[model samples]
Target: MRKIASAFLALLLATLLGTAANPNPGYARVISAGHVEGVLPDGSAYVMDVPTNWNGTVLLYSHGYVPDGASNPARNAPSEAVRTALLDAGYAQIGSAYPETGWVVEGAMPAQLGTLNEFQARFGVARRTIAWGTSMGGMITTGFAERHGRFFDGTIAMCGLEQGSVANWNNALDTLFAIRTLLAPGSTAPLVRLPDQATAIASAAELTAALDVAQTSPQGRARIALAAALRNTPAWTNPAQPEPDANDHDTAQRNQFGALRQFLQTGLTWRQEAEAHASGNMSWNTGVDYARMLANSAIRKQVEAHYRQSGLSLRDDLAALAAAPRITADPAAVAYMIRNISFTGGLTTPMMSIHTTGDPQVPVQTEQAYAEAVTDAGRSRLLRQAYVHRAGHCTFTAGEMLAAVRTLEHRISTGQWPDTGPLTLNRLAEEWDPAATHDYVTYSPGPYPRPFHLHR
Candidate 1:
């Protein structure tokens, strides 16, 4: 699946909305509802929604990844419902289309910064500015809070990959490598630095077919469960539906297969992102210990239960994985990724991050990794994380989003974090709009399987 944000009606609206370039090397369009949208000469687009009741505060949003072939641009907000709510709450909203997409944080960093500067220049400086993002945008927003802390009063990130690109890509590499080695055995599927989209798709098809067959029997299910467990892939995969019952063996296998399918579908594409930036493969598993990793996984109990149900020995599969050859990274490419897009956990502003507990795209463990980093840096007081029990990536409702914004705003203004307990946050989310399905469950994320080390 392409990792772009929920396509805004803005794309369709942009066609109908007329825009003109000004003396500042940028263009602006005034649309219905008194909203102003624009595009910069650098192929970056932006939108600013200022309601009649201006509150002198601006929420600048960073969006998630846009795949290589994406023709349309990302919007300021995920949904009009979110935009309406933000504007109605007396907050101005702004965002950039970004010069390019697909894990291009190098471009995004400056693009977002320039958008804020452009907004300030167009309309006088705001009394307060809050940075916000979703998914990859969440990573960008977190990076913004860390690097440009002085410019924003607060930050909000949702369903973000805070674990940093290196760790995030490497974690996916673990699952893909395991699936190929354990499930397909000797079949040739591209594992790293895919040459092209066709090759990547073919490789994914082979792995996905193997997974489908594996889901049919208890023995195969057990082995498949072991594969997903090695990387802490969640069994929850669908956001449109409720979570599967933990005790149902069939449901467990089915849910886990959903995660594996997601990897096969989009996980292989990481090679493209890394290659784009690093100019070569930067993922590696040379020192990985499959046995130790399984023992340490958050889903260990689930794997054990499935193995018992299968009446098969899990040790055999694990041994095979341990004996299999490992992948290595190009030292130069690794350095490029780290230098270009990684975070240092050096937060100097109040930041709030939210994620779905069972997100398959960007796992909740990313949050854990980031939280630990900030804590280690003695910046724990400036960070807060919340998890919703949902399954898909960036599946937040407008209400849940607004609740998070308010929570961060309170912290930024009061010099202290508010009651952000799951109960309180859920109640606040529920109060936003009953029509929006908000799944805020009390979930504590496990440690990330491969957290990015701040030091070399």
Candidate 2:
């Protein structure tokens, strides 16, 4: 009897571990929380969790960028808190590690679709499915809505770069270019046409060091302010610290400096990676008007104040920018960025975007551009956007996320948008998880500094 029991136990383990997905990858297993882990046909690994009391729903998650060296690809989730909470709430969860990493949208979209297919094959299709993504994943989620909307019930894009890669990369390039032109002219940062990946990484670190030294001097701070304004980077950076006091020019400049380094350190080096993927330079500053950009900046006064304190000539600096040679985009690369993907605002699914108001990296302005896409496509009613009063990219509480998810779910179920105002959502979010502060606030972002798109 003991020998028979041991053999049965071994067979159960083999069935759980070996039969996770189609063809049974053999490494797949039944983990804690009744989760199944396996690999897909495209070499993308996948995992799905089903609660004891399944709610007939699945949340398909797409994750953000993972650097080349650090591509774990073990799990796909926006955050651990969201994953644990959603699974506990009886919603089935599934995600896939993309076949490649680092700004890999082309691979992400299909990998996600395959994961959903794998999920259906293994556990059977849920009654409803919602796709959610963060950062780059959010961008992928947007594309999914455009290309494959009928598959999911709805989508939630948190801190997404949904404004298309061409425009977004150009924006990042503008900031890094300004940093190079204004602070360290010809400092070997390799803004575009990066020689290699190692040089690209080194250049980013070099720029970070330069920003650090620049912050100590008034001249450096003023230039940084100008660059931030041109880049449309928000003056508030550190989430741990409160927003800098208005009229505190020094502190504000400090905040801008922090924003530049905090976000751009990684952003600066990404051009090389982007160029490799794009097949040429996709960013250009040839015709950008420096004076006009500064004039329109919300932080215009802040830049002027910094220059005045430094006893520097803002006009001269602007003149210098006007005279500086601009980077030109390769037509082929620009075509790749465009033809590869562009948001037509043709989201067939009811979509909701949640963003932090003070993100210097993926600015809140991205949502503005995406709104235009939706409006232009005549699908304005299908989209709703909400924001959190926080700094940093994708820095959202699980409660805030759940509230937005619930809001979107309610809209899908009822075919009507609930009170999406910040106050209502904040109150609702607080009701669910009081420990996590919910600061969904009424806010509208200004124009994105750079935009490039051609949808056919």
Candidate 3:
């Protein structure tokens, strides 16, 4: 009897490990995977992984922007572990490393469709498809849902700049413009593109030096805080470090300044690219009311605190901003942006968006802006937005990602939104992957001061 029991136990262990090593017969298995040329000039390349058991569902992934000179193929997955889990669960995954990457959504949308067509030709048509993306990719995903909503059953946009690149770039311009006008008034640094890359790089270096010097003074710190407030820059920037206590004013300022410093390093390059895309300047701040903007800022109290700490007059700073020469967008360029990139919140399918509360690159306020737009369009019922307490762009864990997917799936399958409160999300995340660093927090997003309003 003992010998028979030992043999049975050994057989059971082998069966479990075998299933773990290879997907079960009725589960995920890579049906086909290889690069297929896209329609764009540079030719989009894609990888499609599907399971043999094949749940009828498919996920089309869109990756974030690859800077002008960066490598084109950014082969990405939500998370490696999540990718494997998804595949094992019979979810087919497809992603295309777009031909050329700096804000190329016009070409990306078509490339994605072409890849889908390819998938259908090689494998079979997916009964259900969901679109998902991160950062600029999120913007692309939102655009896809808006334009091609019928093609997808659901969508997930993560830390996306759904307000359109125009509003996004303009908001960043407002912050840097304020910093330059307030802190380095004498420096004639160019905010838009200069004659060449060398000039742009040099300007970036000079701005960095100015910011370094300014960081040492209370008056400079006060001005930096005001600029950060104007742009709604978060008071937290690092995800690896412990989040500052709500009352820690000094740490808050440090975080804000760190974001400002990061923007300074990339501002020139961003402007140069924006110029190329719009055919000229597309960001404008000309009739903006500085005092009103400050009043509306989510971090007004922080600005006030920093001003008080610096013994500086807030009124003077506001006046300086109001009196400073404001930048204006070229009409043609503005029109280009309007048509090429923007979301009307006309969601025809269920959509879920997740954002980090302290993402310096893409502020949480974007969630509010999108929600407002969706509500205005009377499509709020089809949309849900969730927040994470983390302090970095696209910093969600595999567990968080999985929980969000499950939530969206529940909505799609049942036509009823699941409980997505912080506690609920945290619980789901822990249940999905207990070892993951789940950073769910109860966060009420503030209104985005500037959004693409021309469309509405």
Candidate 4:
């Protein structure tokens, strides 16, 4: 980093000398392994670490969604191992905890930038800066890259919901809607307009009880399959069990049930919080054609086979869904969600993303959807996506993530992408840490079942 102007240094000498009120004042070379922890101007707590052997590069990490109950100001990275590896590799790291949690993309985006500004003011600008995030952080990363590409040399997103906030809730509504209409027809499990957190919790528990009973009968299993398909949920919920065969409908239904047992409640609670943020319901199904949606779903085969196995007519379920009363979104609430964040694809920085092939929370198909958006924005060449053979959300080892980071760094250093085939990536990961098993694989995910994109 270039030296700060002498005049500017003199002006802040008193602060640097350390006043009684400000012991850890700014503008010093962080030569030794030291941590600078403080809250940003926006009240977001931030943490920064610089190694003795600085590599002239900084990694800006944006963490994933934390529910309100779990929100904290702890300054940390997504993973301890990854943070350690980055420091060991001589990369400075910085991140901030957003002021609010649970789908705070609007808040998170600025919080990250604020953290970066703090980093620049304390220490000089690094030669290179890389922005990376996971889950909702990934969404923030995508938007940040587009809006502030000059600030970063590259961007990396892992298991991210690149489809943005509006699409996320809309797709979730499809799954919850099907579950309510088909599984708990006589019961109350409002998919939207949740009165409060308690109501959402009760509804989720009620739906879960109905789900447990439905698992006993083939008829119920078939409907579960439909709901899962609508959300593009994978069939690999059990970490202990080996991955089921793609054509195995029985195992698929079982896995879907296992995931939804928790996901149903998760969706309800998250929607409740998100609705509270928007100040009204944001999901709707007024004009959606269930038959057409099921027909277009990537997991349609599983839904069809499960229905056939139960000796139930898939048409009947579709008809029932068609006849069910539809929900409409409040115009103001819809606007709030759209402004929460959306993508233009207008990617200026090189972006690398990795995902577990079977992530149930943020499905691999989101990668595909985001790729198309970038392609439409004429920025396809700036993006590269890879998948791990794991079976859960953000289940990547530190090695897997660094392998991707090295690949992007290579592109940054050489101005061209390296061979990112699964074989090549797996090799890179193994070299990073021979102890951690890497499962990079060549897989193509299908389109997201219910896509919602920004018109702009």
Candidate 5:
């Protein structure tokens, strides 16, 4: 009896060990999360976070621009939220701070893929790979899809800026000029006002001061007041609002001023060290240089010419002075942007792009240009679009988010691409309200209001 009992115990132990080794039949066990260093072909080191799971799908995530230098992708609240959501869905998440953030895609792609290779080696699983991102990440992913379409099974880009190339770049510069002209002080059709020029300058100064004060007093009322004050201004409204004109400038300006104020007050701030940590570059000199260059004469001539060609006049517009005309092609910068673009080839992967119709930071037309390009290239079958009818930056409702996730998962699991037939404006006014107006505004979709196109 004793011999028989010992044999039974040994068999049970072996069974338990086998179960531990194999765990879930359809999903890999949660392995670990750690930093992995990826080296680009150019020999630059990129640091990223890996959340291990064995679901047979590895996701490569690229982070957006870190203008203030914040580098840890894992630390961003939005990124953390998305990462958690994806991990819970049974994917191994690889988050990388790709090649010194500021829109440098050349070095970023290799570093991102290198990290993927490392994750694969560490886990020993030959899983399908997907690429995903928001804003700049979206841009980088699109760039990669355009060049390396075969690398990713699918891509999920949220509020990405897909406009590059000479034409798109020129359009972007024109929009910047318009914003400057509309927002500058002493302009009758100003997009926003701060009581006076001093106030405008003070608001920017106050933001820096509040950041300093908040470091010492995290919950200070002064910061709260500043935030509230900023929110009350007009410039803070949707950055994607229609351009200010003599007829609508007052209302738009008020809305924009309030919005800007609110953003500065409540937005996150990284002190000098924190910015340095995120950006990897310690100096704030790049931003300063960008600003100074905008003020230079040579650049102004290029900007003025571009504005004229776009059918916008610089004459008699105080806001025009804000235009940075000299923003020409920096070979290094363009090369970086191109690298990210080529890393993810376009229209080859199952992709769903959603953008707010009135996104200010990234113009809605940017997405349109991408979709048009895909269509023009005969790759429209692989892409679908959802447009939000709101005046916000990449803002989406919970329902929309869930819908997107479902569409993506369905494509990944069943190899069935979703249809693009249900495209419609996301918002509606009261039932009694008339049909939405279809004006010929910049970035508005439809035929021109008159014979000529409304150039941006």
Candidate 6:
């Protein structure tokens, strides 16, 4: 009898290991295809894609904002990369270009999921679906999950803005104000020396006028110069690295500035489109407007008031900049800083969020805030978080990301929670000393009081 019991236990262990090693099949042979259009409730068109294989698990991907609506529907290279990874792990993926290529989460979510539902119905498969996005896409996914939790089995929000209403608006306002402050009258003088006071004033005037023109211009040249100046100048107390020219600029603009512009442009366009539709312009889907309105009541008023206070005069700045033979604006290259941190608690689905500790664009603190919010709301059991030690924006190694994906897949498939051990800061010695027992602190300008590094 004892031998029989031991044999049974050994068999159980082998089965468990086998299940972990070969949990899902048909994950191979995943193909990336594109340009599929999904219809919203209003019959207008939106675009999305499907990772081939119909794995009974669908991911409704929300993309980060893009300046042009046409760009939103454009297949994201990263999304394609992730799709191949998911296919290898045995999952289907789908994503949408938000309405008009703006941050119209309300409209876009329905259109995307509706399309997925249609696909499922057409395929006759009863599969679980997930929602995921990065940055602005993350924010929208959080909102959708909060309202329509029943539709999804889980949500993976990366660097998502979870706070809503005043917090969200204020965060945006603060970032805009930071950019405005960086360009204020005395801001650029230290970066470039002028022959005289008149030259200094002329430069400031030029910059201010150029900004105004860029604001209304379809292309974003003046805005790009402003970004370059902000990057180059160390006028502010907490100075960010200046924009690099060509080679070094890859990480700065490609990742940081590029993401910022996409978010701001997409978000702004989405808000405007939503407002237009709300005020009886129903020809296009106004679902985004409804969500934006619900998110914050005073967004427009606050932005306008701040814009007036900046006194940067976009039109005047643009004219001044144009007059400068050497200076040119690149509207496509404007950098946006993330702000207006907000979150929605009481999530119904299990969530696993991860962010790098050394991320420059979205601070690690943002991730902590989200995790804390989830815990405070009494949903800690339903959430998990992991922190990587890498730098830049969401720049985890492919192997690290693959491990995360596998863990997530296992949880979704078997209802078994994967272990996310204690979070550790990468390159600990560079940032902290476990044995030294020392204290360190870093500071930023006013309104940004959080210590950046306390142990380095």
lDDT of 4 by residue, 1-456 (tens): 243345544533433233222234332333344688776444566789988887988988988888888956645467888889888888899998876677677667666766777778877889988889998888888887788787789999888988877778888888888888898896666778987989999989988998898899999999999998888888886556899898987887888888888798689998998898899998788888888878777789999988888999999999999998888998888888877776777898999999998888898889888888888888888999999988888989888998999999999999899999999998999888899889999899988876776644
Residue pairs whose backbone atoms clash in candidate 1: none
CA displacement after TM-score superposition, residue 9 of candidate 3 (Å): 56
Q: lDDT tens digits, residues 233-318, model 3?
A: 88888998888887777788888888888887777776776677678877889888878888888889988988998999999999
Task: State each candidate's clash count.
Answer: 0, 0, 1, 0, 39, 24
**Candidate 5: worst 10 consecutive residues by lDDT?**
446-455
lDDT of every model, 2 decimals: 0.79, 0.79, 0.77, 0.82, 0.44, 0.43
- Comparing 1 and 4 by lDDT, which wins? 4
lDDT of 1 by residue, 1-456 (tens): 011122432332242223223245356777856476776655577777778898988889998888777864647786789888878878888898776656677667666766676677667688889999998899889887888787889999899989887887788889888888878899878788787777788888889999888888888788888878867877677876767777665666677788788778877665676576788887899888878878778788898998888898888888888888888998888887786667778898999999988777787788888988888788989998887877788888888888898899899789999998888887788777677667666777877887886843
Q: What TM-score number comes out for model 1?
A: 0.90
Top candidate when judged by lDDT against the true structure: 4
Query: Where in model 1 is the C-alpha error above 4 Å?
Result: 1-25, 31-34, 434-439
Could you tell me which 10 consecutive residues in candidate 4 have the lowest summed lDDT? 14-23
**CA shift of 56, model 2, Å:** 1.1
* Residue-level lDDT tens digits of model 6 in 1-456: 001134543553343333332234212221225235443333323344444554566666666655333534423224455556666655655554543443344455544554455445444444676777776677666765666566677777765544432233333323332334333434442112123334534544544554454444323433333343222211111123433433332233334444344334332344343323232111111112222321232122322233344555544543443332221212111111111113546677777666554444445455554555566677777676665544455555444444444455666777777655532212222232233221111221111112111111
Top candidate (TM-score): 4
TM-score of each: 0.90, 0.90, 0.89, 0.91, 0.54, 0.52
Model 2, residue 275: what's the lDDT?
78
The residue ranges of model 4 lying beyond 4 angstroms of the native Cα positions read 1-33
Better of 2 and 5 by TM-score: 2
Candidate numbers, best lDDT first, in rank order: 4, 2, 1, 3, 5, 6
